[model samples]
Target chain A: MTRARLGLGLLGLTAAALAAGCQDVGGTVALGVRDEAVYAREVHAVLEARCGTLDCHGDARRPLRIYAETGLRLRDELRGQPLTAEELGDNLRAIEAIDPGAAAEDHLLVRKPLAVAAGGQRHLGGELWATRTAAAPTCLVAFLGGRDDAAMADACAAARAEVSLPPP
Target chain B: MSRRTLAQVATLALAALLAAGCLGETPEEQAARALGPDTCGGGRRRGEDDDEGGPEHRCGQPCLFCHSASYNPGEKIFIMAGTVFTRPGDTVGVGGAEVALEDAAGHQVSVLTNSTGNFMLSRGSSLQQRGKGQVRVPFDLVYPVSVVVRKDGVERKMRSHIQREASCAVCHAAALSATSAGHVVLEGP
Candidate 1:
């Protein structure tokens, strides 16, 4: 074979590879599978801001404590690393509670405040966040759905307008 | 991606495959999902509808784990219960002490300790000041509330947020030393 023919064949292979590797705006390379890295960056902070109030998940006794230390444990888990036995159990239970395919509809998000308008009952914690899509409830919805941060921020900001922080 | 030359792209595919394998769901996560905890003290316990199981089933603290502590179905839990003593090491319960919970909405729910130094928060009694004879709009499901304990007209306020810490003994345990006996105790006159 000639040098030109070999170069032409290589170019064809590269083209096919590029087409297969095309990705969406977010960093996801494929459909399905939850992205823990995005969750750690965008959704985790939102949880800390909204859920980590005094007398709530901040306490050790609550079912889902959202203390800063817990965030560390979550970060480790997101990286696909090992968790302490205690952290593993807690995280697994939490993961089980969530529906990765339908994160917004998860009991965790739906049971929060602002869910009433979204066809969900009023949260005793008073609606931490909301969205037009019930199955895709909060700003974390966008992040969970593989949307960019800009989209998540916009969604959460809208939900925040309707949200009233419980009295101090 | 534009910065990648032909040589880089060829190598990139192989790197991506290797990285994906390393960062994918781990065996520990799978084990945790499958086997769960081996002991009662393993991890957080799921709330039980009826109080029949041992510590493993009821180990969740703050009382919400086993009881529907909230007025709203959204909270899906119940109020707190614990015995308060006159002093850290005393065996005697402090009766007639005023236990009030102030929520973020400025609503106050107060109850007196029974003879056993036990008190339970009631939805009927909450929203006393601003509820206007209606179910309080914002319920105290998992939000933060300030717990104020008063006796002899003197008040002791807990400024930290205590979401579902229904069982005070979870933090306040009996010990012989200052550091060891970390229990919530009211001062004696």
Candidate 2:
């Protein structure tokens, strides 16, 4: 074969190999489907406030590190810098990776912070949702359940409002 | 385990020395080890009410780093804390400055910086804790505090509300980065 033909043949083989490996580990995340916009608006802020501190999940040493403008950032980025789209994408992947095949109630992300009394596993971070009615937890529940754009947005607004108001 | 970074190694060494020094201490001695009264940031000891000395024991470090329940153990806990600097990238503290906080419940309270420019909002053991030129509400602070720092009539307000006030430097690092807005500064970066 000519040199150009040989190079094309090798490139085609590599592409085929990569494509073959891209199978669904979990049925939730479809191939090439990451609902970043919905997550950015509804879920990202919740994560940043709850888990994005450098002393917490935001630490670079964590396996599921959360990057945000408030605490942890991508390498070479200043703290005051904005959370870029790529960072949101990175956060989504990290969050989804915690048992992607599981349902929202069964997912590690939900089970970790959930209260022990609520049947959740032990989490050294303590119980974030003592009763599971808190805004952040419910917001995550909505998003991870199905990331329905409208439902997630409503849940997000409720969560933000709860954060704004003082305890009655 | 992987090699410890310089920061980690230095922290471990300091912790070891501190632990060794406190190994034989009594309960009362342990309680007195924390540097200040419940809320005032001016590095005063347990009985001290006046800002007579320089900055608190350690200047420029985040107040809550060692003031929380996790770190101080038997010592008092500081729910919100941080240091104010003279300028960005500068370690010189802005003494006598004011850190004003407006919580979500419309509770407006402010505190003056100690000689070392450290300010912490703590729930004192008693309601008698006080600071010069500032007033603190007796109730717990509502979250999402709006912060403004003023010195010499020149005020610099933080553009963002203090979302997570567990420690100012928790999100505000000594070095500016995408994660930290740097230390609370009176001036430039």
Candidate 3:
């Protein structure tokens, strides 16, 4: 009986440790997904289509401009460059125009086209991401955690939990 | 060494372990502490308001992302400091011009200029400089900041689309030429 109790205690300790390891309370988790790669695959095209306009990000006069001539070329260029190289630096800066630390707060993901109820802000250029839930995946919601922090954090937490498990 | 005794001990140990792992300051509280005081960027503390029934003087912690001189891959801090003037080409400061910055999230705060026309949108606390012209204040730089100045029934808004530049004097400098207006001026007298 004493031995069985000790074994159970050990199992509980392991579970507690695993739980603590999985929680990304302070954004400590690695999130397993590289935001830059995700930006390349899911985000870059949308930004080019919506924001890279004649007077907006594509324009040099504007503080926030996306100068890429073509979406296909832009993706190829940004993704191909080594991290240290200064290629597509301005585009990256536009992506992080708002808080880079919190995706939900990033202006690129939520500002313009998105409605007030969906956490979008007013932009002189006009709205980009219009709805939170549409027939197809609104690229903005997928990137900005689908509406708020709880959803985004859950995704991060899930990624971390999966990564924490020992490989079979 | 009964089965009941083993089960009770295991249950108590598990509960204790769970309690130890789960109890502590919330994430928001930890973010507040990590960023520093709630002066310009976080939630307002109890009794932070003045006796005259003024607005709470707290700001969000995210301002460090842009305004902080010291930054890393992790976090930052800022000194909510700026200046206000009578108008373009005027040397004298505009006392009592209400200077306010509204973020995209709709969080806003305002402060009055001193006799020098300098307004560091802070509470009574003096700003501590981190770099040249940089001070510590509760400012989150994530949302776009809109700088507005209202005085003598006249208001002036920034022509630039976004308030990315926190240091007002950097762009709205003292005039060096005829075409260049050294200071930010109110549209009306």
Candidate 4:
């Protein structure tokens, strides 16, 4: 019951937690869940730029449909309008519909459109990222996998930087 | 003339002017014109080669208005239709251009603009254009489509996806500022 023993025990617990929290960045899939704040900020832009083109997931008929400012909007309106909060909610619901209350990485939401070498299946969208090591899919996977905030931000930022909406 | 006669004559003249104005512009046309009134210049007059009659009619106008017009407005629900113009102020349509479209389902369809720079894809659409005349099309368009206008090896790809607005003119109206990004301009030679 000494102060030294208590301090040592706390340190040991902290170390174990940190290691457990580390994302398994290789082939191994992480246990996943959707994050609203991260999705609204970072993840949605990645999807909009890569997958949300009209000939792709931007279509409402598609199961994992996406809406973007530079891609598709849910309704007919001005072009320069930014993505609305309601539209973001609609997109989140579309992702939620894939496998309600389940991990996203285990589902097609994360698998399809991913590189074959990156453990993704060839879907209608084909391969978005050539490998899982790429920033976009990595960011998406890490966010879906419920990785730490710092990890998610880094991955997402890197992914966002590489993509931009094509000029109209 | 007496004061009463003069007043009566003035009233009749004012009434004729208002009536003529109403007869000239329909409600929808007025609404459409109001959307972007200045792009085509004030008190615009039709040019000699302006879009009129057949599929080539109504250039720089909200095309889908034909869908609900009282007369023989349109045969089918034209899902995708627009006029490609060389400049914002240019009323003449850019003909011989290729309009490429791809839907969410990975289906791609391409059509060429006739002399009037008009192209359309409708649901169960049978009417089409061959050269400067009308023909039939076997294909149908799926909604939420993306478009690209190509001419002279130049590609003007649309930056956003269309989510069920049948006419590009709905967003790109007579007034360039009022419309989405102006009327699908393909500037330069």
Candidate 5:
């Protein structure tokens, strides 16, 4: 009986070890994992959802088109090369500050305001900004999550303000 | 076990521990460490009022606009131009596009695409170069033009392939688009 109990205990330990090994460390926070390929995807999604829409950055009518597919086609129309550490850091800081705890940063909530205040044209819509404050952490958080929402009211408002658009 | 065997087991255990440590922390942890923790408490608060102007103008609204460009002191300004083609009568707005210029060192200068499918960056500016003017720049810079177009209520985004002036010349050498004024056209399908 003693030997059997010891064997059983050893088996349990092995099982526990195996389970621990199978557990995922990256889980949800995996979004923050900054692989070049993954970074490309994350940045692309964030730019598209937050920056690309309406006549802001989304409108082909605008100059300096920054669209979803910008990552693949960055060699043609712009000078220099891919994003640098500093630029990415700047973008991340802008987005992260507004919607802390989100996987991706919402540039609309934070960056847009700073840009507009600094005399930069607003690339986001006005509606987005108006509703942004109300939506609270979710809108900001979602932006940081790099998730796309069909109705980005807050972002729209903030963007509109950045461009000095009239109130709706 | 013998002394040699004991030492070998210890070494093996140390190697395993090292491997486990490496596998323990993920890229996100590293990025968070690099970026720092979030102290903002993951909630929205209203403080400042965002008052810019009246409602945003729709497509075809005439307005004066400026393209973003950088003027680095020690580099020539490489202007990238492109075109966005649309239906003859359809009024579509261009905005929320990603524009970028990258150097060989992965240093990128970027600006959002505006409502006219135009983005520009003036590298080697006097301000960037501490009041230096006209410096020799390399052609190694890559210019990327991309934009999102919104018609009615739907949004469509497009990005051009990474091609330099030299590469573009391989096809449109004779009818090459002008670099001045950052003119690049996007023809819709």
Candidate 6:
């Protein structure tokens, strides 16, 4: 009877180990899948909505350039630049929200604003004022008021819907 | 006598005649003879009979006059005229405020206020001889007998006093107390 009890205990341990391994595998698969189309759409929408209008982020005269043309190239520009932890966290949250499973989150929404943060009020006002444009509908004021979560989530859904990659 | 002696006698006689002519005239008579008639005229030369020129005085229309404190030369003390808002549905009519420069001896220099509630007090060209120093200027509100407003109705007679630039040290300090005050030291050193 003691030998039977030992066999049952070993089976239970093996089952628990298999369950933990399955969870790890699932997390890895979720992170590894690359949806390039979704990434591109998200990048485009963020640029259009936040950085494309004149006299705001779109104006080249501003110290920080948030125009759509340059904004799309943010990933390469911001690659090893040092950022404050608060800034890094804001960027990480934005990236994670847009690309849920992607390992490399390269987006202008995080990098451009972080770069312009040093210009203080003028740059902040310009970026906030640019949101009045119809094409780029998101305003920094709404984002500041905690209303950006739904807007960003909708943008993410729209991007995912446009993605054409087949299921693995 | 020799010919030279005879010539000297003739020169002495001429000198004596000239001396007699000079002694016969009075000082005023000589002066009258020197200066021609009509010396004082509407457009005559000096010392003439009709000479009208005396001393030049400031004659043009007076421009707006403003004055600053002597000690704190930058602070402009002016009477501010505006309707004062009283508490609880009352608007007081302030016709003008009396702004003055107070000396240590209890002397008050009164300044006039214009229609726009602006008054200027400065040393005139003749009064510039007084040394520059701070003067205390106090403002007194001139309340009208009755203040009538279309909506707010009438207000009671109210009197209030406001004091500004009372002490010399208020403006004489190294740093300026208010940004609106003009530069203490005038330009062109």
Candidate closest to the true structure, highest lDDT: 2
Give interface RMSD for all predictions: 12.6, 7.7, 20.6, 7.3, 14.6, 28.9
TM-score of chain A of each: 0.45, 0.73, 0.46, 0.71, 0.26, 0.25
Please tell me how candidate 2 rates in CAPRI terms: incorrect
Write down the RMSD of all candidates, one decimal each.
Answer: 18.0, 12.2, 18.7, 18.3, 20.8, 36.6
CAPRI-style grade of the A/B interface in model 1? incorrect
- DockQ: the better of candidates 4 and 5: 4
Q: TM-score for candidate 3, please give it.
A: 0.32
Candidates in descending DockQ order:
2, 4, 1, 3, 5, 6
Where model 1 places Cα greater than 4 Å from the true spot, the runs are A1-93, A103-114, A121-137, A147-168, B1-81, B85-98, B103-106, B110-117, B120-189
TM-score of each: 0.37, 0.60, 0.32, 0.47, 0.23, 0.16
Across residues B1-189, which tens digit of lDDT does each residue of candidate 5 receive? Answer: 899999999999999999999888565344323422211111222122321211121122211111113322213233443222233323332444443444334555444444543333344423131111112223335323233444345444433323223212122111212121122223332
Error of 6 at A70 (Å): 13
Q: Provide fnat values for all models in the order shown.
A: 0.15, 0.38, 0.00, 0.16, 0.04, 0.00
lDDT of 6 by residue, B1-189 (tens): 999999999999999999998788564344334433322121333443333312110001011111222222123432321121212122111123333433323434543222222223343323221211212234332211111112133322211111222221121222222211111111110
TM-score of 5: 0.23
All models, DockQ values? 0.07, 0.21, 0.03, 0.08, 0.03, 0.01
A92-145, model 6: which lDDT tens digit per residue?
344344434432212234323332443322334333222222222232222322
Which runs in model 3 stand beyond 4 Å of their true positions? A1-168, B1-68, B71-78, B122-141, B176-182
Candidate achieving higher DockQ, 1 or 4: 4
Q: TM-score of each model's B chain?
A: 0.47, 0.63, 0.46, 0.63, 0.28, 0.21
lDDT of 3 by residue, A99-151 (tens): 45555544444655566666767776544335655311244445545333444
Regions more than 4 Å wrong, model 6: A1-36, A61-123, A126-168, B1-189
- Per-residue CA lDDT of model 4 for B59-98, tens digit only, reads 6666566643242234444556778877666776788888
lDDT of 4 by residue, A25-87 (tens): 555323224666768887887777667755467666777877777545666663457778878
The candidate maximizing TM-score is 2
